[model samples]
Target: MVDRTPCASTTAFAQMAGLDSKTPHPTSIVVHRQSRVLEIEFDQGSAFRLPFELLRVYSPSAEVRGHGPGQEVLQIGKRGVDIVALEPVGNYAVQPRFSDGHATGLYSWDYLYWLGVNQETLWNDYLKRLEAAGASRE
Candidate 1:
């Protein structure tokens, strides 16, 4: 029988050992304006293509997420938001400058992973919120 467990050298294995530095990091980042998507490939060989509108609405900045609980600003009318620039913030995060002049969000690696994992569910929730608030994303 073949053993399916990952080897010690694998990024997942390192994460299991509590070595934060050994976590999967992005190997490539591609921003495609034509598709309005940001593609990120990790060291684990997994890739996530995130939309610019989604990224803008879910920005990790205080202006979007707020400084405390129950303070999140509902992002609407961002269906056409664009990513103007992607700036590396050290080795831990990236600051995406949006066409709307928003540039404070610092999207960390962990946060990106979370976004990739929960994107669909979060998107549905956002849509529901917008609909309930009579907001139109035009």
Candidate 2:
């Protein structure tokens, strides 16, 4: 069942626009715990299988994103992070509680689509950042 919880005011605008025309809605969302992948099929016929690690590293929470540009916190050692719970946030997003106790990210349809489309670039950039910082994904 889709949860109807009201979104925080900060995300209310996105929720309203999320239902607008051309905004693709998810037809299915499945968590493959064994594979540590989140499989999502959108109504627009696009599908993506995003790795748990990628999701955790790219979480949209304040902790990860910070309050302003260039303030993004680089996430490391999240290679093993997995979603323990996934809950709906109104009709707009899904909040995932990760095994590492990270549950603040709100994965919106638009953001998910963007991630799917840019997964390669994002992953590559993340790796580059890690290497530059001498950080390990472990």
Candidate 3:
């Protein structure tokens, strides 16, 4: 069974995240360079803090994920990647540029929530893949 979330369950933010269909959209999104964390908050009190490395590795770019089946590339050498810029893409998404010259992914509200929801499992899987491929986070 899929674990349905609360914050993204019945708000506009959730809807944007492709989550739910209620009011109270996202209120704020902040990026912290020193801590390498991106913080997002919804009007319904839903908030998440995402790491730069995770964001970089999980970027929603065709270059990283590819446009077909089994085309996902494993990103490496991004342990210290930071969000250098957060350019707004109209009113729906934000384009975050990484310090390592990665600036193609556009993160939507729903996408951010999805990442936060599955972060633990995704991070663990990334670690496993890194170990198997002998890739370093450095």
- How close is every model to the real structure, measured as TM-score? 0.83, 0.88, 0.82
Question: lDDT tens digits, residues 1-138, model 3?
Answer: 976765533565445544445433468988988899998888778888889999999998898899878999999999999999999876667899999999999887678777877989999999999999999999
lDDT of each: 0.84, 0.91, 0.84
Report model 2's TM-score to 2 decimal places.
Answer: 0.88
What does candidate 2's lDDT look like per residue over 53-91, in tens digits? 999999999899998999999999998998999999888
Which sections of candidate 3 miss by over 4 Å? Answer: 1-24
Taking the tens digit of each residue's C-alpha lDDT, what string does model 1 give over 79-108? 888898999977777899999999999888
Q: Once model 1 is optimally superposed onto the true structure by TM-score, how far is the C-alpha of residue 98 displaced, in angstroms?
A: 0.4
Cα deviation of 101 in candidate 1 (Å)? Answer: 0.7
Candidate 1 TM-score, true structure as reference: 0.83
Clashes of each: 0, 0, 1
Candidate with the greatest TM-score versus the true structure: 2
Candidate ranking under lDDT, highest first, comes to: 2, 1, 3
True lDDT of residue 58, candidate 1: 93
Residue 62's lDDT within candidate 2 is 89
